[model samples]
Target: MGFREYRGSRQHTHAHFVLTGHTSFEDEPPLLEELGINFDHITQKTMTVLNPTKETDASILGDGDLAGPLVFCLMFGSCLLLGGKVHFGYIYGIGGIGCVSLWCLLNMMSLTGVSVWTVASILGYCLLPMVFLSGASIILSLQGVLGQILATLSVGWCSLSASKLFVSALAMHDQQLLVAYPCALLYGVFALLTIF
Candidate 1:
């Protein structure tokens, strides 16, 4: 029978039928997968951030992701908030401006230029140390000698991690120091934010 004839015959049957294997039926992914938070990816990035001298896998760091960065930035802001410093706006604002500035600077300095998002991701991932420093400030006043030392170390950690990633991703082996100087300056700003 023709489709039209079958439909006409079923007109008196007001019920609707849907096939389980219909084209419209789709299996949704699990919540974790849908959220795009790859634990493995974040773990690798975090490890690299912790160990600044370690060589990063280009394929991993080159694939820019903002999830870890967003978490670190938020953590830094939250820790600062807990420490009685409400600098969420400064955190995000400095982060955005710093990422753009680094993106521009690195592009000019490297043969294989990078995108702003990639720069942002790398910088954001490196912010983990700063986040920790911010968290520490909650229990200890950062205006003293010990606090200054910790803040300096954290800034170095962030700068080294970010510079290493940027250099490896962009193949700027000869210009590591050049890349690191700006990274240090940027992270120094973040350190200043964490301190005062």
Candidate 2:
């Protein structure tokens, strides 16, 4: 009888909830709101990509976020696919190599080292212009003068924005052009991928 009472007391003690009010289902955020916040975050990052001259917040740029970049890469590849090109392998290969190379180069160049994921994130974010260029290729032939112009503009935009973000995040004020040179090369590859 005593052992049964002791067992009952043990069960009663273990059954109580440790978390009270905060664990309630009503406090959880709705799905749409969470999605909206994520969208807003992506938009802000894109805005940073678009505006090269504007000072970028290091926190935003240095978080080493990859979701935006992954989406951009997939979008770029998909746009190319839609345009009758199956260069997904080339895209992924170049992106991975470029990010690693840039990470190494930036770490060597800057006092503040950079993360590979950050390099990838910046490269991916900068691909926005490339995405548009790839999309434009779908609608019209990108071999003409107008296509050349668009491709040039897109490459320049991506390169400048990427270099600017890197310089800003790494605090390499004087080496913006130096940073831009390699960025131009990287984005130039994407431009070729779009054109051919």
Candidate 3:
């Protein structure tokens, strides 16, 4: 269907006709006849529209609050299990915490029944940059440039993740937020396995 404006005393709008699936203007004789509109000798125009309020089932998959802290614990535990000695283990554990925390935050934001596009946009512009920075920090650390830089970056990612979690919590209602907590915890456990 398409919208058309009627030039009356007051502005009026209405849908003209429905377009059958994959049917071009040339094939829409019935639609043309019903609307008393001509399909021939008319230019076609394409327009894009975005609905910010549309939510999808995919948004319900994860939660952040429970996942964040659980992930923090698992990462720390894995570092110890790997026999990372002294400060080395602690550093690796902290890095894991940051990555997991961000993942949790993303999950939590999704549970609020918000628009999928908005959630995707936020993840792309915000969460992705942090992940990239943390990955780069890990690479630099492996290269033996400066250990402190890696630590700084890892902690920075965690801090940003935590901040996003808080924002998502405030934006969503209490009951909905509570429901997503379990999934977040599961995410944390799974994340730990992946890292180890």
Among all candidates shown, the one with the greatest TM-score: 1
Residue-level lDDT of model 3, residues 30-83, one tens digit each, is 854565333221111000001112232222223212222233344444443443
Quantify all predictions' global Cα lDDT against the true fold: 0.87, 0.87, 0.36
Tens digit of lDDT per residue, candidate 1, span 35-101? 7678898899999999877768888877678999999999999999998889999889988999999
Backbone steric clashes in candidate 2, count: 0
lDDT of 2: 0.87
**How displaced is residue 160 in candidate 3, in Å?**
0.8
Q: TM-score for each prediction?
A: 0.84, 0.81, 0.26
Query: Sorted by TM-score, highest first, which candidate order results?
Result: 1, 2, 3
The TM-score between candidate 3 and the true structure equals: 0.26
Question: Which lDDT value does model 3 have at 126?
Answer: 24
Instruction: Tally clashing residue pairs in candidate 3.
Output: 0
Give the Cα error of residue 193 in candidate 1, in Å: 1.3
Which regions in candidate 1 have their CA more than 4 angstroms from the true location? 1-36
- Which scores better on lDDT, 2 or 3? 2
